[model samples]
Target: MPGREARPAVEAQLLLASCKGGGPMQKRFLFFLALLLIVSLGLLAACGQPTPEVIKETVVVKETVVVEKKPVKLVMSFVPSGDTQQIITGGEAIERLLEEKTGYEIDTNVATSYAAVVEAMGAGNADIGWLNTFGYILAHEKYGVEVILATVRFGRPYYTGQIIVRADSGIKTLEDLKGKTMCWVDPLSTSGYVIPRVMLQAAGIDPDKDFAKTVEAGSHNNVVIAVYNGDCDAGATYVDARRTVEKDLPDVMEKVAVIAESPQIPNDTVSVRKDLPPEVVETIKKALLEIAQTEEGKEALKQVYEIEDLVEVDDSFYDGFRATLDAAGVNIEELAK
Candidate 1:
């Protein structure tokens, strides 16, 4: 009986050992070989298909674009007129005229003071300027500004500076200003100060040493008004200064008397920086002359400078202005600031 029991257990062990033999190992090896064969066939089939060709191409463009550039910008500086709004509006109008006539781009600047415009010329900030006779002299001699045109006010290429007194003040001559309070518009005024000073000297009176009090009334209109109001015994201003205040003081002409008249004075000038191209200068002058011929243009310019026309002129026309300054012993280098 014991032998029979051990015989069954031994049989079980033999069967288990037989299961672990070549059958499972051969099956696993065959499976891996089949998988590798399938992978190889897939790769070969993929390689057998025709490969697509790559093509490169070049393209050409055949159009051209041409650009036209505009002219250089021109900037003009101004010494302000009586009215601020009038000065600005008139300046813009004139800039428009320049552009329309010259085919140029134009801009404008109204300097805070007359000397500011002069300094702008010296610094090359301005290409053109509106300068008074004395201011033109200062800019020409010191800053290389050239007068291109002379502004004509009231149809005259020349004007006169005057010494004015209230009509009742029996002060009839320049000598009467000797021991009295004197008002001068400003040192820069050719008519108001410079030319009148020369006139006073020619009459054998020293403006510096003779006057009891020398007052700067600030402007030509103010100079006339102060004399008319009896604030000043006598004053110097442009001969046309009474016209400036005629509307305000309708009897301005009746109230103020011209004690003396200065020698013929050149009108204000239209100037340009000296280094500008001559052709360009001539073009500007031409445009300005055309502007003068049109009534609307004159009316527009009148607000700024009372200019009715622009006339051809030479620098020699201002020689008298220089001589007057010289006769007064005025050192421009000292007076210009």
Candidate 2:
């Protein structure tokens, strides 16, 4: 056929042209043309084929963070009205209950004397104080300590001070106490010293000069023990304080007799420093009231200060007691100084 004859003729022409000794430039041009043609064919073949699939991978990372918080802390101080160790144990129990209720860390301590407790509240070292009547008065006047609660005993918000003496001492009357040795709880003690002193003055006897020797027994329990042991001819304490020692001294009630009882004195107080936060004070008051209702709290209160219950009170609660002190010529300002 004509097509087959034309293809052989073109091949014969190309072979003859290549066999001829062409110039170097002409041969280079021919070689480039051949390469260009081959590349074009390759591109056409590639375009005709299907395209390949491509995949991309991604990596993820995560981060975590944590935070820590610290608890609020408070300081509570107690007046050593009875045994020091026993008071401390009770105070600790109260601290735990308060901490659990309020979610605040509480530290408790019993001061060596009533004045120490007052001073601690004044100096901002103690946030809470268990203060006696006279001590509370002094603290309130000088430092503006605020009373939040009053302790109850024998179902009474008020308690009386007693002038106690051994049954065999023959000290049947306040006048008979003259020229006799006397044991006092502490200078700042309300029932054991202050009110009893007022009682003595009303009877025409001076506590400082009438007694041949006066001893500060440091605690009501100590005063009771001192009188029972005859360390002093007579002593003063809270009414019926002899029962505190009845566990150890079974004959304390028989050996020590109450010769006299002072007029009604306000019970001890649960006071707070003047600068304490009002919210904190309220929290403490609420926590204590709740704690007092529990059996554990009742036992703790009994151990700390023979407290039967706690009742809310204010600065006015001590007004009658203050008037009695005023009439008795006891100056609060002077005592504070």
Give the TM-scores of the predictions, in the order they appear. 0.74, 0.80
Residues 74-165 of candidate 2 have per-residue lDDT tens digits of: 89999988999999999999999999999999999999899999999999999999999999999999999999999999998899999999
Residue 281 error, candidate 1, Å: 1.8
In the range 171-281, model 1's lDDT, one tens digit per residue, is 988887889989987666678788888888889998889988888876677788889999999988876778877888999888899978888889988999888888889
- Model 1, residue 61: distance off in Å is 6.6
lDDT of each: 0.81, 0.90
Off by over 4 Å in 1: 1-71, 81-85, 331-337
Top TM-score model:
2
C-alpha positional error of residue 277 in candidate 2 after TM-score superposition, expressed in Å:
0.5
lDDT of 1: 0.81
